[model samples]
Target: MSNRDYSMAFMDGGLGDKAKARYRKRRKALAKTVGMPYVIYGLDQGPGGGNPWDSHVPVIYQDPELLYLTGVNQLNTALLVDPITGADILFLAPHDAKKEFWEGKQLGVGTKAIEKLSKEITGFKDIRYIDDLNEAILEVLKASKKRSIGTFWHEATQGKKRVAQDSNYRFKKQLERLLAKERPSTKVVNIAPQAWDQRLVLDKEDIEDMREANHLTGYCFQDVLVAKKSLKTETDVAGYLNGQLQMRSPFGQSFPSIVAGGKNACVLHYTKNNDPLPKKGLLLLDFGLRWNHMHADISRTIPVSGIYSPLQRVLMDIVLKTQKAVQKATKPGATLDSLNTLAWDTLNGLLEKKVLAKGGLAKLEYETAPHRIGHLIGYQVHEGDPFRNYNDVALKPGMVISNEPGLYGYFELTINRHRYKEWIGIRIEDDLLITGRGCENLSIDIPKTPDEIELLMAALV
Candidate 1:
């Protein structure tokens, strides 16, 4: 018998049709808003090369955009929508007998059984194989009076020179070519921007995923605290934390765990978790979990010895205070740019007052933590660059943003006639869901106070 239940080749993460219908419906709304007849979303299931890496399971990464629109994830899934009539079609891959015993089955166009299953899963009236994608596009174009093409491709160019960002952008280029030969004087409107605008705010279904993952993210931090006493290296902490997270959720880390010890913490975006735990500094842990297609990012800077020294306590307080101030200023109308400015002002105030650092210790540069404090989080750890286009977008209810403020610097200061020299990096990151009155700190449960962390880690056997 063929693979029963038709589990996806991936971890089969999705809310099915009902929860994701809002995203699919956006295609129709987007087409109308952009004045296009048809909108096409063609997503490729990667590593499609035949018989390569056989038997070795390579996990599939679902693009945040694709997953947001269609909850179900599999190989080569596409959706074609005709805004004129508010009709949509879901394209999928058919079953293969060869891999039935191992990789299970996928949704596709076929017999009544297959069609019903696809319809029930995707909530689309029409279900077809991906092979029909080209023909479907041509027909949608030909049938409509509008001489135009609709697809999401944020084309990056240096004056007509094609400069794509990543593999996804490269693949979108292929879809552009499919529609380029359609006819003369065809209008190409990029629906991608509109889709991104729609994605900025989370719907009810999305918020649930975000909240669950966030709660578990804090739990994962507590799990590490219990084992941190025995974990002597950064790599060990990362491995153990990630292992415990996956044991609970279907998917694992949003990105490689950033486990930095002591001065290594100053190296932002540090992923080389091989340093030994230092006897006199902080350990920065930055990690997130993927739950139900939504991601939650959290960062905590804690003392390596389960107790913060006077100097370490000041540094930790600086970061925690900066984060608290930003969180307080997060309102529905405040923009990311404004929030980030508030973060820096708060940090600088603390340092300028000799609360933690001296004048020479704080500098706004790539190595420091002031430039980029947070990013928009969702299906991916980073949805977009906060300093770029995402900077000025006003925080409305349902919009989620990250509030992380810290200082990363190298300095030597004399305290009580004792000279201290090290690279100090402390960052506290939490997801803030913009609410009507204010914003909710989704990761607030994660222990960050020196007293709380000391108590938690001190419990370790």
Candidate 2:
């Protein structure tokens, strides 16, 4: 088990003050949308929530919306934004020095240095102990003429139908149940959808942050390629990438690294990096590293032995072509739903020519790689609202989204009058910037094509 100290990764990189200001404006905007005389409470997620405290302290992530809006990334804290007032409140636990000795320093109301920093950085009107939350909420509710309260309801993977299983959801339900028991007149509102839409348009600073993250992730990916020939197993590949990321980044991987070898790649979300390397097949790597709490997601499939087979090269071209088609389709005024449809149709069109069997597409999709086209990228890996939630929302400039479309399954077809059966997985993912005319692939410069991968590998090794 990792030491508790190493479990959490955080590096503000001096962007905290500016990010907080931008987020403050976002809260005010949400305030206007929900109207003044409203109270919105956002929670900091509890310690990774699972079985008990025997394991290392998990990453005590702040609710993405809470961190996005309030810039307070600490445990045991809750934010209450009073849109009607000049500044909202941040309630945290008072310091327990004995626990701090065991765990680590926490941002509490007791420590003078922490007190000053939290106030300066968060811009909250008041920072009180967590014990004051109920009284504070009561006061805000009484003053909230709208008779409503709000909180963000996304848990990063809310699209997976496990919405009720997360801390944020529990926070929402608790508020509802509490109000029903004592304050029946008040209504609980999910301000997440509106708050999420607000994040769709990234400011210049936010975009730059993402680009920097992509640039560093690209660097680490190159380093991974440099060591790829020596990587003898899937775990070796993942470990090498993790080491590279640690060398360059204070905060490491944004998501669990996927380093699947050969048929293991057929599993779209494959994360078991324990398999031995295949001498003659492809290795799929899908990983993202974080910078300043922003995430950069990129996936590339390369050969295990530093060169792609003839068949591997051909299938790769098809996936790349589908990706290019979808890239061209992404632009301002284009709906996400349409882009997704176009991607699948274009891919199926290309695949049908290669596979001559009834229901081939269904078999591949359902049995192998069944996933939505992409999603918005930001503070959290999955970020705000799922694609389906805002499927009809037109793509706009300043928005960053992913474009990942691929097919993975056993390929059984008649080629040259011979039976061809092999499990191949080819997925090329990139972070894209939605622009006025068309979108730009932020990770495009990272070598991906057969020629690009081969030449780079040869040069490095």
Candidate 3:
């Protein structure tokens, strides 16, 4: 089946219609705000060099903004939106029979089958071959009264120097260079902020996609927990979880799976999953599944043994309590800063009560909770906006964020030198959908509490 047909079938009747309506509203809103002619470019090709891991493989990803507007995930596609008329034109690369012979067939432009399918799926009336992009852009800019063009532009880094890999940054620069030599009077403007603002809020279709993604992620977690006793290495557990996700969802992982075992958990963002599982240490699993371009970010740490030791249980309880408090305070009008303050207060209050020791409280707070409480979860795993440190933006309804609070006892850190001698790390994360009254835990089905985790692990033995 074609990409459009596959997406339509995946979303089905009302859901598909809702997505189309969302795209229409978004386009109209953009047209009203940025009152100028604009073009959005998708990824030209896959990332990496001509090496085996790079361009030669079939690993193309569409630009998120372009995908949001056109509902087309295929590479080498572009979208032009007329701000004054609110009309959309989709440009697709011409079909290359030779390339198709080596690779698979793609949705070719100018064909009756593709034209009908594109209109039905993307809701755009005008579709043309990408070869006409230069003429189309010039005509649109000339017709505009202001002679202005708007597109996204942001700097990208490759090693030391700023490099343009597959981003619109390079494309925008090339377009500017072309216009300078051709239409010297016309100017290019950045509309990324305006475009990103529209993507901040979650629509009904987006919420449904996230819900299903989290559901599948929770099941994968359960499968790994059930086989914890049989698992010997970190890679074994990571492979099991990834295998489950692939079997259930069409998309791959949101990011590399962090399957850190024992002391390795203290190191944040550990992606190397080759360490041996400690017979009596904690296992930290930080990973998420992506489905239909939406993502679910989740993390959970459990005992490698059937049950947590007394010290591990205490630390896990504190982290879980902090996470729950953050979730409870995540209604509308709450800021991430406020929630983080609450987390700090909860952790500090435990220290004040002499939970750990007298002087080590400050050291523990600094080392254990080094990272922020959570981040906004969406198309990107760390979806930017409103969830950054000290950002006072109020949480509104239809915003999905992650509620993750962790406590790590690093071996080298002086904080873990005394009473907590054994290397230990504990984190509890849940994807939350902010509602009018409160937040719903999208990953509620996954086992988290000490008893729940112990029970699940006991069954594995």
Best by TM-score: 1
lDDT of 1 by residue, 1-461 (tens): 12326434322244433443565565656666766654445445354444676543324465556666565567677777776655577777776656556666666666778778667666577778888887887787777666776666554557879665544455556656776765645666666667777777777777888898888888889989998877899888989988977776766666677999887887888999998989778999888887766788888998888888776776677778888888899988898888778788777787766544443344334533345767788766777532246778777898888888877876555567665666788888899999999999888787889999999888764
TM-score of 2: 0.88
TM-score of each: 0.89, 0.88, 0.87
- After superposition, the stretches of candidate 2 with alpha carbons farther than 4 Å from their true spots are 1-13, 36-49, 53-60, 111-114, 154-163, 354-369, 412-421
Would you list the C-alpha lDDT of every candidate in the order shown?
A: 0.72, 0.74, 0.75
| Models ranked on lDDT | 3, 2, 1
Over the stretch 1-461, how does candidate 2's per-residue lDDT look in tens digits? 11223223222334544555666677788777866433344444355345576454324366666666665556667777766754477787787778778767555788787677556655565888887776777777777655788776654445566544446677778778878886899888877777777877887777887888889989988998898878899989899998787677766677888998888988888988999988888999898787765789889999888888766766788789889998998999887688888888878777776554422322464732367678888877776564346777888898888999877877765545655467888889999999889998889778889999898889998
Task: Determine which window of 10 residues in candidate 2 has minimal summed lDDT.
Answer: 1-10
Query: Against the true structure, whose lDDT is highest?
Result: 3
> Model 1 Cα displacement at 147 (Å)?
1.8
**What lDDT tens digits, residue by residue, belong to model 3 across residues 142-247?**
6766578898766545589875443778888988997998799888898877776677678777898899889989989889888777789998998998888777
The deviation in Å at residue 64 for candidate 3 is: 1.0
Q: Which ten residues in a row have the lowest lDDT in candidate 3?
A: 5-14
Count of residue pairs whose backbone atoms collide, per candidate? 0, 0, 0
Clashing pairs in 3: none
The C-alpha RMSD in Å for every predicted model, in order, reads 3.5, 4.5, 4.0
Q: For model 1, what is the error of residue 358's alpha carbon versus the real structure, in angstroms, after optimal superposition?
A: 6.6
